[model samples]
Target: MNRIMRESRKLRSWEEMKKIILQRGSSGKDVLAPIDEVFGRKFSVIVDEMPPYISLRNGFTGYIADIWQIISSELNVSAEFQKHSFDAGKELIKNGSVDLLITPVIITTTDIDEIDFSIPIVKIWYELFMKSSDDGATSMSYIVTWSRNLWFAFLLTICILTATLWIIVNIRLRLERNRGKTPPAWQTRLDFWRGYRRWAKGPEPENTLKNELVSVSSVGSSFLFVLGALTNQGNCLKLNSPSIRTATLVTLFFGLLMYNAYSSVLISRLAVGRTTLPFPSLESVAEAKTHIICVRRYSFAYVQFKQREEDKELLEKWQGLVNEPPCLNTTSVRDVAAALCYDNTLILETPNIVAKIIEDYNRSNGCDITRLYGHYARATATVLMKKHFRYRHHFNKMYYFFFYFFSFFSMMINAMLHGGKNFERGTRS
Candidate 1:
């Protein structure tokens, strides 16, 4: 009974000391001395494999690991890293089984209350990843060169010009008739017969003023004339009215402009070999009912999608597709890539991570995957630690220091390279 009482008292005293150390640490005092005496010089870190940020390749090496290394060396402490799934890592941190999680954790409202996050080390945005289409520049390239609205406007312009020309010619004909001008002699039946009898020996009588006026006054003839001018194929019909002549010239100029623009765009598309995607954008993806594959349930991408009120319909569609058979909740990058290449699916992830995956995959397999659509959502990523960690402030400071250092170093290197190129050019000149 006496021994039990003594042990309990010692435990109570140790707890009190830890509380005091935590208070000092929270108050911005140097509490490392107490932490060292009580906890030890080593920490246990848990991490998930997120490429370009925290990867397990070559035994735990990446941006976050490097930062952690710098901080640990500065503080003269050591860490033991263990690989685990993101969910498992979070559970460990919450239960006080781990000191830190070094994966690139996107900051979300739901996680703020459970775990603490360090200063943002990187900015990340979600993008769509899918397999590149095998067919490049499909048969519909010419038709798709101009948008539907542009085509509609072009057709409407043609109709308007045709109507204008027809109205102007009819008004001129009416005025001439009102002025008591008689039709040409060739318009009479006997004269027409005589002209047809002489057609083989002389110029055709259809070119006479009466036939020209008749053709111009007809709506179908006006439409054909306008279309021919637009296509750079001028008609043979003669127009005497100044207004009709002006409208024809305008149609010709507009046709030339539209033709040049269309030709330039088509040539570029064919030259660059732009692969047409099945669904060009997120809205189209939803409309096409393409399944979305994400790393895990409630992942950052999923969370962002859910929180966006504007994409409510998209969110519902995603939920419905994800709940179907052939589950897409995969953690392996290779599996995600395979699913994208094989199935009609799209994966959502950060640009850098997707690029890394493509680079690595292309090294082994052929180039098959590609990034589609633009960024979907932007978020800042940081390392997650246990709530109220004693070394949180210290880690944040060191991380910021190293981040700035590397950025400055990269800028200097680029400047030096550019200066060298300029100097070489001057010397050559």
Candidate 2:
């Protein structure tokens, strides 16, 4: 507030002081008491210009105004809500110009030493949104069939319906032409109409059924149904039934047992034939016997690769067999994904930077890398905070709350979208 104090503090820029007042900068001390005493009044905090905290009108802004009002009322203080760009908000807090920085701000240990924070207000979960490739390649052309197990099951049903309907139509036409009569049952007529409707409208049952069935069931069930109809009527029966019985108790029992045994073998065979299969172990990928994989340099993945001593030897052994060594190296994640786009055997590398990469890929229409590799690739977003900040406890609480909240909502939305796609895919497959 004064020239002597400003000079003694070695305040560098207006931008820094502005961030300091807002608690946005990571390099400033809390001058709240001093500022309040000197100004003889409560001061304002700097925040972003968007809603949930502060808004213009229209729809709800999630939690901004609520937080501002609560902090002000409880502390017997008032704040001037200054709207600025996200970067400017940080600058304001850095320069000791604002009293607090309140918005959905990420706080980490590195950030604590510079400026104090209140409890974390909110947290976020991230995901990758990719333009799906047919054969795991970058483009769609390489995809021969996009079979979701659910879709396959549905397709099986369509096939059975089509065949049974064909048989009925033949019978009906023959009876009408020769015997000059309708089919014996009305159910048969209904079946005919249903099949006709499907044929006319396309293979899908109808929008209403699609929405209802897909919403209620898991993708796997839908797939089983489709597969059952396409391959054989008995397929669905076996999937739905744990056991079955027949009239010729002894002979029928043996026959059913044999059918079950054969079906198991056939199912395994079908699973093997599909192009999209579970990835082999990192050891296997490292071996480069029949495939290639991209991994980050000096990263946990690279470390793991090294830890698997046998796998390392295998890579060296196979290096001479290929036209060139299959090692693709790059720092940028997008570039690595691009490399994976064209290479059939290559799997791209993903490091522990989930939120940042997910947001980028989603906005950029890049690689679909949502298929996480278990604990091996868990990336966490952390807040960088400064040391000795007065409000660490307050910030941590807010941060944790947001972390869980955003993660839950984000996953829910993803699951909803995933279910729709999975249903259609499962049915076709």
Number of the top TM-score candidate = 1
TM-score per candidate: 0.70, 0.31
For all candidates, what are the clash counts?
A: 0, 73
Query: What lDDT is reached at residue 407 by model 2?
Result: 37
Q: Write down the worst ten-residue block by lDDT for model 2.
A: 239-248
Q: How accurate is candidate 2 locally (lDDT)?
A: 0.41
Task: List lDDT for all candidates, in order.
Answer: 0.65, 0.41
Write model 1 residue lDDT over 1-429, tens digit each, in one string: 223222223332433333333333334355454435323378888878767777777877777677666556655678898889777888888887888887775546666777988888777678777666653577888787777899999899989988988888787777655544444775756577665676658653343444467656888988898878777787645666677678777878887888788889998988876666566666676677766555434346656446463343436656665423343456555555545554565777777777777666543434566667677766576878898888777766656555644543432343344544443343345
State how far residue 86 of model 1 sits from its true place (Å).
2.1
Whole-structure CA lDDT of model 1: 0.65
Off-target runs (Cα >4 Å) in candidate 1 are 1-42, 66-78, 106-114, 179-211, 276-284, 290-295, 304-316, 323-328, 362-367, 400-429
